[model samples]
Target: MGVICYTSGTTGAKPKGAMGSQKYLVVAGEIWCAVDNWSPEDDYLSYLSPAWATEWVLGLSSGLRSGTTLCFPEKPETVQSDIREIGPKVVFYSARMWESLNSTIHAKIADTLAPFRLMFNSSLKIGYRVIDARFQKKPVPLSWRALYKLADRLVFRYVRDRIGLSNIKWAYTAGASISPDILRFFHAIGVNLKQIYGLTEALMNAVHRDGDIKPESCGVALPGNEFRISENGELLVKPPACFSGYYKDPEATKKQFDKDGWIKTGDAAHITPDNHLVVLGRMKELIDLGDGNKFSPEFIETRLRFSPYIKDVMTFGEAVRPFVCAIVVIDYENVGKWAEDNRLNYTTFADLSQKPEVSKLILKEVERINSVLPDWSKIRRYVLMHKEFDPDEAELTRTRKLRRAFMVKKYKDLIDGIYSDAGEVMVEAAVTYRDGRKGVFKTAIKIRDVGGA
Candidate 1:
């Protein structure tokens, strides 16, 4: 029997169901089995919900087609422990989960004893160089290779085992773009981490091939998939596993394809000289600053979120403003630990954020990020939010994507303050809590100028 899978509803629109034919599922599975080098002997971890297209293709279809044994975690909370025990050969975790794992690993490393910490830090440096060389397809020097092997055995081997990735020969991150730092760290530690780019509409698009991986590009297109850049810079995909028309929505489906029958991906991307796909960002999400400087806020936001102290970010300055600024949400656990380590007393997230020390810490991070960004795209100033953006309040979508229009409308005053000469702004925000309780969150948010371009 056929099955129906609904969209994640992260586009701030009604979820549309896509019907999958049994034949189509088998074909999709066969494609993944071939591309990923899956075999009957391979053990696959079934984690992501089958509602997601990636899981449907990679976990369900491929598992069936390849005759691979599939294992499921006992419960949602026990996935990590179960992974450690099973040590599956293949994994397809979401980008967000990879970032969380990276953060957790770093936090654990930071808390280690001094001698072990020294070994871990040194081994990581050696490992990064080795991984970078391998990714570039350059031969590792004999001396460095020998040292890397030692580092891998002493530190990285244990780290990978602890993260339940020691046996992962084909680990993948998809669903959304991930930070390169996370990808690099995993590869450095010998996890063979790679990225796959696809959409719910296009089942399997592109993935990094072994020995040809790049942190910047999402690797070459699959054998049956073709990608072309449209005149307006949107990525167009033609794949064998294309979805049927949106359920009961022929008009929407008609608009999603061109006269030539290629599916419009709505993502801006460029193909590298090596035939790798380098996705920019959503074409509709580009911020055009009247004078011709246009950039994607997601690019800067992703880089900013690489910091452990920062949790969520929403950047502003499109048509109305000349420069960029951001609203930041701090990571409560990490920042709270920082506060406690420094003997700074803070009862709440709001109080901790307002502390001069905390502001300075975030300012340093912003400045560090600015050092590598182009002048027009750099965040000139930013305000730390006392409370995180909530999906219940429509600030973020169910999948944690920012609803730009909603954010612009809801935080107009805060946006105004960022452009103004105000050092700080008092905002009384009406928040909708998770329990459906409404309350006013009044806090004076500091707007620190990051001086240099």
Candidate 2:
């Protein structure tokens, strides 16, 4: 019997899980075996939630069937220590994880490294490698490439060493779209990262090849990949090594499977001039900005999240407004580093975000992004969330998706406070303290002036 895992359904949408038979595992095993060129001596780790379909296959079965020693972190905060201890030959993470790591790295250091290869992506973007070092900003007078090689060796090598990514041969990323800055940083450094597109249903459909890695496209359909575009621009796929069907939800299975046996992926895609596939946005999540202009939340979110301080973001516009608005979450550790680097004093995340200087920084960033976007698609107004998104809080699913519907309903007062004229907005929030006591705080959030992007 095949196991099935659904899309978390956090977007107020229906949940549909991928179903596959024993053959799903069988073919996935074959693809996994050859893709990374795994060996009996490899060590791999599973840091993703077991409930996610990608983890169920790649993080679970791929490691077991291939003889890679699979390890899990004892605690979430200990992921770095675990990676250093295990020194996995292969690594995989979601776009969020990559974003978090990249944010942490960039906020702290912008250096270059020696030519040791480290793969660095989930699935959202790909074809990057981080070397064991980082380079400093210096004007290379001549063929300074030689000097950069020296600086990478002497200075940047410590970066990968600190993160225990010295020996990583391959890294994979997926789930959501990765920020362009984050994607460029890794490849520019020397990590062998590349894009791979797959769903729980089709499993692994498109993969970047050794020579055909394109930064903008997901890559060509794999060796046995078959695909077509529907009249509405949806991508329909069939792959030999992909998962076949849902385990038991025959209704979902029937809904996803076409009469011709192609798996109907609700995501839209287009074949580029170079033959690579560029995924647009989900068919379901399209937002109309009330001006007959459509905005892809994923697209807008990707741009907003390009700000290193933004760790998580969700925008709402749909049928309500002429422009988009957003809920922003800051990555505390990184923002904390920013605070320290600039000697900006703040007691907590709320304190830091509410500071006029910090608020201006975010405003400047938002405006920078909005300037290029059409007015209807731009994020006109935003609210900095005082409370961080956490899985235990139910604001996020186990896979770390923003439960937009849940959050919109649960934090209705907070969301409403953004549009209110009170410059300072207040809401009562219940949270579990570190001491395990439950308490409620009437938190106050200060709205930031939205600038052009």
Candidate 3:
């Protein structure tokens, strides 16, 4: 075997190492290059961990095969600056990273001078119209097209340059589910961001092609990969170069594939008549409200994350609870900036998170998401978390995918309070500092109801 890449463990289970032969890595790389249209002239940023299967396929194998120049950042903190300096043509980021970039852009615009901000917002409206028309396969109005061109010159161009995306030719986001709205936002701003879907066990399977982009789908299956939706709605794939098996784990390996040798993706999905692949959340992760209502938490969480104020969110609904509730993590930097601008004082993350004003701010965002959801699946109540989900704390994977089951166990009290009649819950959390010192603290976290629910 050429490599043994471990799954990200976002499903709240122990990660298994998927062994890949040299031919497997090579074929995966070749497929990626061909689908993304990589060439010798392209430049790529190498920021993802080497241990990741994606890095092996894109940075190592593909770089060698396509002869693309791979540039490494000086350090993790310097990635943005390095991108600004090097301006690589290709970049790949996880969903969280993409959301962070979107948040940063909006936060900066929020702080801009009133007149410039107004102009930018107006231009963006026109841009959105153009993007919508294009996605619907309708002709864009000439006036709207002209206005979009003007916007690109006056607003979008500057935004792209500031974010070091001016030279980005092919930007891809994966590793977790992302909001289609986020994809539309980027397209509206002239960034060619697309979603690609694959897994460690099954390499590259589907991607958005240049002229055939679908914000709501992961585009079509790659040239050498085939997809089939099983009887129970699980996405099954037969990739050109599937992973050999789980390292030293025969039982797990056997369970990964069906009798026909098709890899069971464990994700619910559908293939559209036009051959596009729309992946739902993990089958096991779907929330069942027991009253014949079921939904994907990721669908709601991704939309809520679009708000600059919300950094991360987890939605919960169970057989015992007919309505959905949520745990939200605020974007500390953005919220802190808002607090300062409004002359609101805060001492710590917990203090800032629990503030009445902050709760109102988050409530607006929650209501925005709830507006688009069904009555049965709407988030009726939510609590702003005291701190961000930490990978070191085992609440999130290194790739920033939530360990849902782990989080449920860890925050059992806070979740119970959301379903209960209580207005607040006392939360005692353990803290681990950078220097390895550990401590514990307690605080009262307020739960707010949405639309009197």
Q: Which candidate gets the maximum TM-score versus the true structure? A: 3
Model 1: how far residue 109 lies from native, Å: 1.1
Please provide, for model 1 over 1-453, each residue's C-alpha lDDT reduced to its tens digit, 9 standing for 90 to 100. 366777766555777887667766877887776777788888899988887878888888888888888999999899889999999988888876777677677777877899999999999899899998988899999999999999988998899889888887889988667777778888888888889998877787888999898998788988789989999999999998677778889888788899999999888999988899998888877889777999788777777777878888888787778899999988877888888878999867677878999989889878988888888889988999978888888777555677777787888988899899999999875655546777777879888888876
lDDT, candidate 1, at 112? 83
Worst lDDT run of 10 residues, candidate 2, spans: 123-132
Error of 2 at 446 (Å): 2.7
Candidate 1 CA-lDDT value: 0.83
lDDT accuracy of residue 71 in candidate 1? 91
> Given candidate 3, what's the lDDT at residue 325?
95
Candidate No. with top lDDT: 3
Predictions in order: lDDT: 0.83, 0.68, 0.90
- For candidate 1, what is the TM-score? 0.94
Per-model TM-score, in order, reads 0.94, 0.83, 0.96
Model 3 scores a C-alpha lDDT of 0.90
Give the alpha carbon lDDT tens digit for every residue of 1-453 in model 3. 899999999878899999999998989888877877788999998889977888888788988889999999999798789889988898888889999999999999999999989988998898889998888788988888999999999999899889888888888888988899899998899988888889989887898998788888998998799999999999999999888899999999999999999999999999999999998899998988999989999889988999999999999989998699999999999999999999999877888999999999999999888888888888899999988898999999999988999999988888889999999999886655456777789988998989844
Error of 2 at 185 (Å): 1.1
